[model samples]
Target: MEILNEQVPAPADVGNALIGIRGGSELDLDLRLEAVHEGILVSGTATAQIAGECGRCLDSIEYDYEADIQELFYYEESEEFEDDDDVDQYWVIGDLIDIDPVLRSAVVTALPFQPVCREDCLGLCNECGINLNEDPEHHHEILDPRWAALAQLSDNVAEDAATNKTSDKREEK
Candidate 1:
């Protein structure tokens, strides 16, 4: 916002654009003013650090984001003014154009739809509700229900054999 002042010397109205972005957890921008044929074209970069949940691991995600912005301030009577296009327009008063809206828009445009913390992150298990990151042992087990039924049948057979042995011993005594 400090850099948007007209008091800042502007480049000659030509093909030049000025650009700068201030760093913060949330960013502030210095309007990049490029001298254009019709008006001063402001273009530059700003950044906002996005910190929140990771989509995959559900861990805290921190991202450094950079965005580019462009804003044009045309004089009311400037030749670029069109009657129909002028119906909905933004204007600058006292030789000053505010670029805050432009800055906000640029940052939003550069953001990812869903930010991930890491590329190869192993997410939490849906069934056991365990954090895969924390556990390196027994990562996963695959079970077949048919095999499980066979295992149960073997256990019952062993139990029956042991019971029959005890009954025979009692009868002999």
Candidate 2:
């Protein structure tokens, strides 16, 4: 049994499109390695600095995320995982275990698919590309295309009514 605590640089492409850990950033790893009957068991946590854009408002978002890491590396001669072809199996290579893939899997899976800067973010206006969070009341007076014909009809009716009223007043005078 052994404890491994180290700070290493984060790898590239450690998350989804919306959010990810920047390459070369600080990564803190705190884990315990144990030798079991089948293989070596690694369980720990990896903390990384996350950076990305908000999916809602396209704003810059930055935060820290800690991902849990746990996996078993089987010895070269071990045949325990041979029956399960669907599951991925890790191996101990030359008395060393490569935890990069394990750490990456842990961090990437925990990242949000759609990252947002805030829960109440109003997002951007589709019509004008303006951030609604800055001005929540901001809007454009855009009438629906389906109702445009009805609006035009109402304007024409008002014009006709005014014209008739003016003619009637002239006749009375």
Candidate 3:
């Protein structure tokens, strides 16, 4: 079977994850089904337009994604494979096979756990919550509270030493 730019509802979000395909996206399907001794082998490729936020920068991202689908739908009444409990197969009802589960599995597995807009994305600034990619030079100087007293003492000591040195040089001159 061949499908051209068919609109299909995407699977639900995966546990509040950042990367996901937008719902009601266009999917192109090209599949071939073959009847085998054990079951029907389904092989196909599904292509769809995915939209999500970048995991690093949280910027909107859009891309075309393709997932390969390959699974077997076993006959429910077949007794030849009843003894084997380790076989993974989907149940076939009458002459129809549920393809939604297969499609969902394929698409989700193909997606990356952390999708980025680009490999070299600079991400956002933790202190200011600004996009570092847009302003690479943005920065903030935050001193550690534990060392604040030591930092002030060190500055005072440096100033005292400078003053002493100047006075001694003048006396020597």
Candidate 4:
């Protein structure tokens, strides 16, 4: 079955990586179902529009995504399975197969773990929380806490040396 431009609700956000699928996004599905001795094999491709913020700069981003769906929906009473509870298989229900789980898994795995707006995106500044991409020359003059005492001592020594030099020149005059 070929579904074109079918409006489907977007998937939920994926942790800090992916925000979520765009609302009112159209998903094009091209799927084929085949009945085997063990179960029905579902294979297809699903394409949709996904929108989220960039993981680095928090900029809004939208893009087209495609996922390949392929799974087996096993019959409930098929003799091919042993009486083990550890097997991972989908069971068919009364001539209807719920493809939501398969679709969700495929799309989520296909998405990038860390989505970026561009290849060379500069992340936010740690000190001021500013986007570094916009202002690459931004900086702060604050010294590291570990070296703060040493820095203060150096400044004081420099001042004392300058004062001594001026006193000696005055005495010479």
lDDT of 4 at 65: 78
After superposing all C-alphas onto the true structure, candidate 4 shows an RMSD in angstroms of 2.9
Tens-place lDDT per residue, model 2, 41-157, is 999898999999999899999998888888999988887766688787899987999998898888887888999999998899999889999989998999999999999999999
- Per-residue lDDT over 1-173 for candidate 3, one digit per residue giving the tens place of the 0 to 100 score: 42334456665552137766666666677778888887777887877777778899999888888788888888888765655667556877998898777877777777778889999999999998999999999999999999999999999999999999999999999
**In candidate 3, which residue pairs get closer than 3 Å at backbone N, Cα or C atoms, i.e. clash?**
none
Q: Count the backbone clashes (under 3 Å) in each candidate.
A: 4, 0, 0, 0
Q: Which regions of candidate 3 are displaced past 4 Å?
A: 1-7, 14-16, 80-87, 158-173
The model with the greatest TM-score is 2
**Regions more than 4 Å wrong, model 2:** none
Question: lDDT for each of the candidates?
Answer: 0.58, 0.91, 0.78, 0.78
Higher-TM-score candidate among 1 and 2? 2
Candidate 1 residue pairs in clash (backbone atoms < 3 Å): 14-35, 16-34, 17-34, 18-32
Q: Model 4, range 47-150, lDDT digits (tens) per residue? A: 77778889899998888777888888889888776567875568799898887777777777777788989989998998999999999999889888999999
Which segments of model 1 are wrong by more than 4 Å?
A: 1-26, 35-37, 73-98, 136-173
- Error at 37, model 1, angstroms: 4.2
